[model samples]
Target: MRNPLADKVVNIKPSGIRKFFDVVSEMQDAISLGVGEPDFDTPWHIRDEGIYSLEKGRTFYTSNAGLKDLKIEICNYLNRSQGIDYHYNNEVIVTVGGSEAIDIALRAMIDGGEEVLIPQPSYVSYEPCTILANAVPVIIELKAENEFRLMPEELLEAITEKTKILILPFPNNPTGAIMEREDLEKIAKIVIEKDLFVISDEIYAELTYKEKHISIASLPGMKERTILINGFSKAYAMTGWRLGYACGPKEIMEQMIKIHQFAIMCAPTTSQYAAVEALKNGDADVAQMREAYNQRRRYLLHSFKEMGVECFEPFGAFYVFPSIKEFGMTSEEFANRFLQEEKVAVVPGTAFGDCGEGFLRISYAYSLENLKVAIGRLKNFVDKLRKEQGR
Candidate 1:
C-alpha cells in the first residue's frame, strides 16, 4: 500500500504554544499562564442577542459574505474608532475567526513562491499559513532593545523582488509589542516604496493599556494596500462564537470572499448576530475588561521587578516576555523545570520564534488571585536558581 499525505501539511509544524497547554490540561494542581485567551465571560448583551436570534429561528446561512447589518456595523465601528471608511458591500468579509481570515487572506494573495515578510515573536499561524499558501516565509527577528517594535531598517533589510506581503501582528502575542503611529509611518513608507502589501492582524487592538491602537489602514494610501483583520474574540470574550471579519481593497476582498464562499459558505449565523450587538453596544463591557487586564498587567510587571526578573514593560495585550538569560538555561529547560518543581506552567519564548530563546511568555489573562499565586511560585523558583549560581 502506498502512503498518501500532502507533503506540505506534513512538513508544517504544530503550534509550539500548545505543547505546554496540552500537558497542563491533565496535570493535577498545575497552574497555567500559557494560553493567550481572555478569562472574562462573553458580555451578557452579546450573548442575549445570540439567544434572541435562536429564538427567532434565524438558523440559516447568511449571504456568502455576511449579514448586511453586521458588515455595516463593522464599517461604522472602524470609521468611528480609527477614522477609516469601508464599503460594506465589497470591502468586508466575515470569517470563522481571525485565524481563518489569516489563512484565507494568504491563500487569496499568494501565487506560489512569493515571499511573505513575517516579523518574529508573533502569533504562530503566520508562518504555517504562508507555507500552505505555497509562499516562502521570511522572518524579521524583532529586538527587545527596540521594545520589540519593527524598525524601518529591518523591513528594508528583509525585502526582495519576490517579497509580496508583510504580516503585521501588532499588540503582538507572547511579546505584547505594539507598533505606534510613528513606527507605522516609517514602515508604510517602506512598504509603499517597495510596492508591498500587508495583512495587519489587530485581534488585540482593544486591549492596549498605554494608548489607542492606530490602524495602518488609516494611514494615507495604506487602506488600499492592507488587509485589516480583527474579531470579537479578545475584546468581547467571544472566542467560542467563532466570528471575525476582514476589510481591504475590493479586488483583494473579492478574491478572499470567493475563497470563503466555497470553503466556509459563511461564518456562524448566531455568532454574526451576536457580533452585531457587540459592535453596537459592547464598548462599555470592553472598557471594563480592558481595565481589569490593565490592572493584571501592572501587577505582573511589578512582581517581576521585585523578584529581580528582567522583563521589559509591555503596554499592550495580556502577556509579558521576560529574559531568563541570566539563569544559564535555555527557555525550554527553565520552563519545564519550573512547571515540574513549582507546578506553574509558562510558555518558553522560543515557541514564538528562535529569537525568543532565553525568555518566557507569561500570560496575565487569569484572575488576580491566580496570578498572585503563580508569581509567588515563580519568585521561589528564581531565588532557588540564583542561590545555586552562588549569586
Candidate 2:
C-alpha cells in the first residue's frame, strides 16, 4: 500500500527543538534550559476571570474574529505599550496563539512559490509555516557581530522580484535580539522602497532589558504595510492557554479572517476571557516576571562569561545563544553529550536554522536556583572536556 500523506506534509522535517526534548523527557534529573517558556504562573486575577467565565457558562464560540471587548482591550494594550494603533473592529483578529496568527498571515499573503524573507536563528515556526503555505522561505543569516540583528543591506540583498513578504522575527526567539528604533528606520526605508509587507512577530516585546522594544509598525509609513503578531504567551506567562492576536490592514486581515473562519472558526472562548483580564490587569505581573528574568539573564550571562563561553549579549526574551565552536563538536554533539554526561538539556543552535550551527540556545526561564545548578554543572562539563583534551 502507498503512503497517504501529501507531498508537502511528508517533505517537512519534524521540529529539531522537539526531537531532543523528547529524549530529554525520558532522562532522570535532567535540568532542561532548552524550552523557551516563562516559569511564572498566570496571574491570579486572570485565572480568576477564566474560572468565572466557565462558571457563567461562557463556553460558547466567540465571534470568528474573537470577542469585541477582547479586541478593544488588545488595541488599548498595544497603543499604551508599543505606541501602535489599530482599529478593533477591522484591524485585529484573535487566533489560537501566535502560531496560528503566523500561519494565517503567511497563507493570506503568499501565493505558491512566492519568496518570504526570514532572518535566520529565528523562531522555528516561520520557515515551516512558509513551506506549508506553499511559499519559498529565503533565509538571511544575522551575524553575531551585529548582535544578531538584520541589517538593511542584508535585507536588501535577500530581496528579489519574487519576494512578497518579510517575516521580521525580532525581539527574537532563541537569540533574544531586539530591533530598536534606529534599526527599524533602516528596515522601514527598505520596506517602503521595495513595497514589501512585513509580518512582525513581537511576542517578546514586553521582555526587553536595557532598551524598550520598537515595533516595526510604529515606524513612519510602516503600520499600513506591517502585520503585527503578538500574544499572551511569553509576556503574560500564558503559553498553555494558546491565545494570540494579529493586527494589520483591513484588506489583509479580512483575508486572514476568512482563512481562520473556515479552518478554526474562533480561538478558544476561555482563553479569550483570560486574555482580556491579562490585558487589563497583567501589567504588574509582567513587570514582576520581567524583573526575575532580567536577574536570571544576568546570572546566566555572567556564568557563561566566567566559563569562557563566547556569546552575544541578549537584550530581549529569556534565551542566550552561545557559540559552542570552542568545544570542537557540532552543536548536536555538544548538546547530546552535555545531556547524557551532565544531565543538562539545552537546544542546539542548528534547531533554529542552518546559520545556527556551532551554537546552543539556553533559556533563562528557569528559577535562579535552577539556573545556578545548571550553570555549575555546565562549568564542570566544560572543564572535563578541556582536561580530556589535555588543553
Candidate 3:
C-alpha cells in the first residue's frame, strides 16, 4: 500500500496533556491536575435549556452562522461585558468549540505560507492548527518575568514581511497569565503599524480574578482586525456542550462562515440554545464559579509558598505555572516522579512549548478538598527531592 498520510498531518505532535491523562487514568488513586477542564458541572438552568430545546423538536440544523437567538445573545454579552459591538448577522459564527474557531480562523486567513505569530506556553492547539493551515508557525517565547504575557518588543522582534496574524491567547491556559488593558493598548498600536491581524482566543475570559477581562477587539482600530474567540466552557462549566463562537469583521466572518458551513453544516443546535441561556442568565453562575476558582488559586499560591516551591501568583483562569527549575530536573521528569511517588498528575509546561521546559502546569479547578490533598502530596514530594539532593 502507498503511504496514505499527509506528512503535515502525520508530523504534528499529539497533545502531551492527553498522553499523561491516559496514564493517570489507569493508575489507581491518582489525582490529575493535567487537564484544564472545569470541575463544575454545567449549571442546571443551562442543562435544562438544552433539554427543553430537544423536547420542543428543535433538533434541526441552524443556519451556517448559528441560531439567530444565540448569535444575538453572544453579541449582547460581548457588548455588555467588553464594550465590543458586533453584528450577529455578518460578524458571528457558532463553532463546535473554541478549538474549531481557532482552526478555521487560521484556515481562512492563511493563503499558503503567511507567518502566524503564536505566543508560547499557550494552549496546545494553536501550533498544530497553524501547521495544518499551511502557514509558518513562528513561536514568540514569552518570559516568566512578564507574567507570560506577550510583550510588544517580542511581537515587533518576530515580525517580517510574511507575518500576518498573531494568536493572542490570554487569561491563558496552563500559565493563567492575562494581558491587561494598558498592555494590550501598546501591542495594538504595534499591530496597526505593522499591518497585521490577530486571533484573540479569550476562552477563559470570564475566569479573570484580579482585573476585568478586556477584549482587544474593543480597542480603537482593533474591532476590524481582531478575531475574538470565546465560549461557555470555562466560565459556565459547559465543556461537554462543545459550543463556542467567533466574531470579527464582516469580510473575515463571511469566509469563516463559509468554511464552517460546508465542513460542519452548523454547530450543535441544542448546544447553541443552551449557550443562549448561558449568556442570558449565566452571569451569576460564572461569578460564583470564578469565586470558587479564585479561592483555590489563592490556596495553591499559599501552599507553594509554604513549601518553598517557586510559583507566580496567577490572576486569571484556573491553572498555575510553578517553576520546577530549582529541582534540577526537567518539568517532565519532576512531573513523572511526582506522579509515581505521590499519586498526583500534573502537566509539564513544555507540553505547551519548548520554553516551558522548567515549569509545570497545575489546574485548581478541583474542589478545595482535592486541592488540599494534592498540595500535601506536592509538599511531601518536594521535601523528598530536597533531602535526596542534600539541600
- Give the top-scoring candidate (lDDT): 1
lDDT of each: 0.94, 0.93, 0.93
Candidate 1 lDDT by residue in tens digits, 17-121: 899999899899999999988889998889999999999999999998999999999999999999999999999999999999999999999999999999999
Report how far off residue 253 is in candidate 3 (Å): 0.9
Model 1 quality (TM-score): 0.99
Look at candidate 1 and tell me the lDDT of residue 373: 94
Clashing pairs in 2: none
Error of 2 at 143 (Å): 0.8
lDDT of 3 at 21: 95
lDDT of 3 by residue, 147-231 (tens): 8989999999999999999999998988999999999999999999999999999999999999999999999999999999998
**Reference-based TM-score, model 2:** 0.99
Off by over 4 Å in 2: none
Candidate 3 regions exceeding 4 Å error are none
Which regions of candidate 1 are displaced past 4 Å?
A: none
* RMSD of every prediction: 0.7, 0.9, 0.7
Residues 1-391 of candidate 2 have per-residue lDDT tens digits of: 9988899888887888887778888998888888888888888899999999999999999999999999999999889987888999999999999999999999998899899999999999999899999999999999999999999999999999999899999898889999888899999999999989999999999999989888999888999999999999999999999999999999999999999999999999999999999999888899999999999999888888898989889999999999989879999999999999999999999999989999999999999999999999999999999998898
